[model samples]
Target: MTAPAPASSAPVPAAARHAAPPARAHAGAPRWARPGFWAVLALAAVLYTWALGSNGHANDYYAAAILSGTRSWKAFFFGALDAGSFITVDKPPLALWVMGLSARVFGFGTWSMLLPQAAAGVAAVAAVHSAVRRSLPGTAGHAAALVAALVMTLTPITVAINRDNNPDTVLVLLLVLAGWLCLEAVRDGRTRTLVASAVMVGLAFNTKMLQAYLVVPALALVYLAAAPGTVPRRFGRLLAAGAALVASSGWWMLVVDLWPAADRPYIGGSTDNSVWDLVVGYNGLGRIFGGSGRGGGGGGFGGESGAERLFNDVMAGQISWLLPFAVLALVCGLVLATGRARPVAAPPSAEAPVGAPPPAREDSGARRDLPGARAALLLWGGWLAVHYAVFSFSSGTFHPYYTTAMAPAVAALTGLGGVLMWRAHRRARAWAWALPAGIAVTGAWAFTVLRRTPEFVPWLAWAVAAASAAAAVGLVAARIGPRVRLRIAAAALATGLAAGLAGPAAYALTPLGSPVNGTNPTAGPAGSGGFGGMRGAGGTPDGTRGGLSGGTRPEPSEGTPGRPAQGTPGQAPQDAAGAGTRPEGMRGGPGGAMSEQLIAYLKANRGGAAWLLAVGGAQSASSVILSTGLPVIAMGGFTGSDPAMTVERLQGLVSAGELRYVMPGGGRGGPGGGSGGSEVDAWVQANCAAVDPAEYGGQDSAQDGAQDSARDGARSSLYRCG
Candidate 1:
């Protein structure tokens, strides 16, 4: 056989043997392998940590309520109880459950309540990096990850919800994970991938109800379109996935259903509803259309102006920062498709044509060149479009924050845009500088708007305008050489990033005024009280205002049976009765200085449990009172009446022997002892107990004297209960 053609034996070149694999083949490496990736990740951590520290108590009211007591594992995991009532109907119980559990573990302080959200935010950044790395080469992937981190850290809405004890953060994280899973499944087409996608979607549903479902079908459809014949062979697997979701989420529904009908006011109309109805109808349909069937009836598109509402709420709420980039990415994606670029080489074929001409390479290059970037843009862009379109067209009361699910997607797309620009031109290499520049600009913007006068800083608005202008210019200039176009693109991205960060930074530094009432002064009239108001007894204007008191207090025997008396003044009481006891006089007595001040006023009034009131306070005071292991009602009156009317209007709770104390010094009732009392103060004194003059310690009086007498009276109240 000619000695096997005497195979030549030339030593393999070390350089050839050691050469690294092609970018497409090694694209899926973990972010930790790259220094730039770690740098981006570290930046995200620092930025988010700063946000957590500086942001005011965004959801302290709910966190306080949920963390106040030892919650059942059942309630902590599946059932929504306690503070659940405040956000009723608007969101599911998962978020509260997380907060409750965290509080149980960490102690229900501001940091504790917010810890979970911050952690989730960090996890989201990591997930974004992982997802991007899967399809994009090293440099592009790192660039995209960096961009994503910046977007997540800088966006106002992202910072607001991630740092708040709201469910939005959890939902956002789940959605991002779900997106990653779905995209991964497309790449691998493995059964486990499908199951994972299903599981993620289910968890997402549990976090915020119908929102997860809305994106699921869209994702599935996209997958089917992108990869032919990859869907499950039988519908049974799909059903199984759906069933798993239901099982995971149904426990809460089942427990909630067990609640007494009278106690389940928010759960009304739920029995007749199907799971779809519960999700799509009540949570989804009802919110948009506004009706009693769902939680809030006046929420949908019909009741409000659709386009304007969408522009303000859905678009502006979550992804406004990425709007320009999204458009640019979309245009680029279309261009990429039309150009028929082949970034990835085809698998080796044994019988390939002698000269196939490299599969007709496009002028621009191969599609695989920006695989990760392309995938991110496609997935996130589609997600935003579908999510906004559905919510925008539906008839529901749209709060800008509800769109938090789209935040990760927006960030991903923005990141992709950055990568695409850099890849398009050698000159654009400088554009990568925009990523860090944008971050610095954003940080500065945050300090200015938040630390200084929030009202005066219009950086967010201006940034948006500038970004829009740049996007227009970049889109037209895209046809230019990659070098020149990339510079413009980098500038545009920097401008957008700076703008995006400005809003949240401003929000962080700004007082946000009061935690209970949202930032918007006019939100109340617009019916934008938020789910927090709906779930709780009602909103408390200021924590120090006062406990519930509509009528004269019942005799000790007249209150709930077996109710214990108030405890010793200095000692916090136990159970409902002792918890309800107020200080005895207006001056120094027996209890500790603070206790005496509170108790003296209560004893002098001698009103029933409902008599206790904090004159100058808001819902936070009520939360503090409740946290003392006491039962009390808080009245939050921002204006004409109590803003938290659910608790305010509950004639039964107010009339019942629940109310007991009154504290008035935090400016709720009237400007601390002004000439004339405000309407709230006038009502408190006329209907509830008045502090005795003897109890009133002079302005310069010693606090100890006032405290002892009050403590004695409070102790006696507790003894009376015993």
Candidate 2:
């Protein structure tokens, strides 16, 4: 296939050139409309949603919220951690709303809660594909498109998160969709599309608090420069879009704020029980720097989360494989866009044109579309750049899986950059520098990342480095021999692909049958056996293991650092978080254990009391409330962190006969470390009567040991308030 012309580098139909993909590329209607695209979608569906129920409630903290919302409209609107709406989940309710609606329509269960994430993941892939086709619609670009999607799909972080129920799934999908919309806005210069893009970003904010603003810089800069209109008009349009964004996001906050605090659950992450405070503090400034804001822990030390975080042994394998390559591509791609078409000089023909102003430089119709090129670079390049900066150094609450947000940017840049470089090479052989440069940078980083892990395959790293190095050399030295050019180029390209893909493929295809627990789970073979924990061919080592079947996995160690004050990962409804034991008939649909005795006790004890039991945090209370479909109060939202109610409030509830039994021992993460005690915990301990641990077979687990403090509150000990 002939190389693409540098003149056609941008995605627009310039006043001069309109080049198609190379002659050998797939010649047809857009690839997106073909049967091939449908097949890809089908394959993605199988990867994302097939046997999804097997995973069960991946993040029981959120899963319990979804279950409660499905049962109570009040809980649904408030994003309450329990059916009683005792306190709202720390973040905004959009993620819960979507998941809750799905569960309501489909009937609540693992499938209902997780199916939305699977569907969102699928749509995100399709949106990325559309962006690829628009930007690189050639046969070579088609290959790039497939490669980009594959890279994203197999990203270990993406696979792990989508397989679970984290709100990040929605955040990612919405952000990618925003990326696609920004491309459209720039392409058509349509102010409405720009507005729509801003609106999506606002919606994303609703999904994950303040983390959604990362793309705004890219969107605004690109539109102001490339969008067709007078400078003032474009700037005005941008201001309009910004207004729409604030309006979209602010409306929800307004509703939540104005709603009487007495009616809804107190905000979970903030010290003052305010949603705006949670947005600006815990999920906002605190995230970028350090601290858990006022009430809980977000984890990580200042400067410790610096650039090395991405290349650290734990994160590199999951999503950093293509990072260096992406950076190289962005730098070189922008440099190429800056080289405009050289102005032509006309012969000073005899005496004719000296007085005629040189015929106005004669229209060549070949001025390179530098504006378009610059926009593409700014859009994707800015995206990759900003997220990299934030996640690398920001000391906020970060998880390795959070990098899934960066995958689309990484994949898009890699593909588009490759296409741009291929086009540029046809102009100047020196432009081939990026090929070798990329290989060197990527391979070296890969080597550093691999060496950090004790058990990584040394040979695989060497092969990747050697093969990619060889290919880069051949591509740069393309004219050495003409007869064998195509074969060598193909081999080089194939090897480059192999080098980039080898590690992630081994990881994604491995049978890590165990449920992916933890805030940050990277994809790869679990343990030394590679596929030793192959999820489902047989039961895993933990006889209760929910391997690939997404069976139950361990919860955060009691009071694990960075364990949010609320919301625990992978806790079965009936199983106590961090206990590693499932209660029989817990969450009846799934074949897991439950707290049968506890449920019976609560139900039997309720008489004149308003709440059967008032628990410290959502973790302790979510399962019981959802299981009985009863009105148990969760004092703080997910973490027992937020001071949802005061000592006086509880005393009044008791005096009014609205509360009786208080199950204060079980955990909801907070400053208390379970035993440290939140304000509510302190009040219960001071004013209420403690029940015997043996009475209910509940044991007070040791307080936050260095290894596992998140579960310090994990006890069956009950308390009598009235």
TM-score of each: 0.60, 0.80
Clashes within 3 Å, all models in order: 97, 25
lDDT accuracy of residue 151 in candidate 1: 67
In model 2, how large is the Cα lDDT of residue 351? 54
Q: What would the per-residue lDDT of candidate 1 be over residues 1-722, giving only the tens digit for each residue? A: 12225556997543222111223524564554567556756755654454242222333234334543333343243322232221132356677767667767754444455667778877887787677655456666666666676666555555545656667778878877888876765555455766777788777777778777767765666455443242454244456556766776666666665655344423312324233445665566666565542435435322254554534422342335455455565565435433444454555555655575443434443343444344445677788777777666666555556666666766776676656544554333433343333334333433333222222333544554455455445534544655576567567555655555555444332222222222211111111122221101111223111111211112123111112233221122334322222222110011122353444454454456533433222332333333343222233221112223232433344466544444433322323221012443444444555433344442224576545445323321111110
**Cα deviation in Å at residue 377, candidate 1?**
3.9
- Model 2, 1-722: lDDT tens digits are 45434665656543123222222224664555456556666766776765454454555567667877876899898887767676677788898998899878866655567778888988888777667666644454565566667677777678777877789989999998887787777766677888899999999999997889988898888777667667898899899999989998888888888888877777777777778888888788877765644422444311247667777655676778888888877787777655655556676656553475442342222224434445666788888888889888776666667788888988877876766766665445666576767766776766665555434454666777787788788776664676786577667776777777776655554323544442334455333111112222122344222332344444323322112222333222333312222232123121122255555666777788756687766665655654565666666555555666677788888899888888664553555533224666677777888765434433446332311222222353467887
| TM-score leader | 2
Best by lDDT: 2
Question: Which residues of candidate 1, in runs, are more than 4 Å off?
Answer: 1-36, 39-43, 51-57, 68-90, 228-239, 258-282, 292-294, 297-304, 310-318, 334-364, 368-376, 421-627, 631-722
Worst 10 residues of 1 by lDDT: 584-593
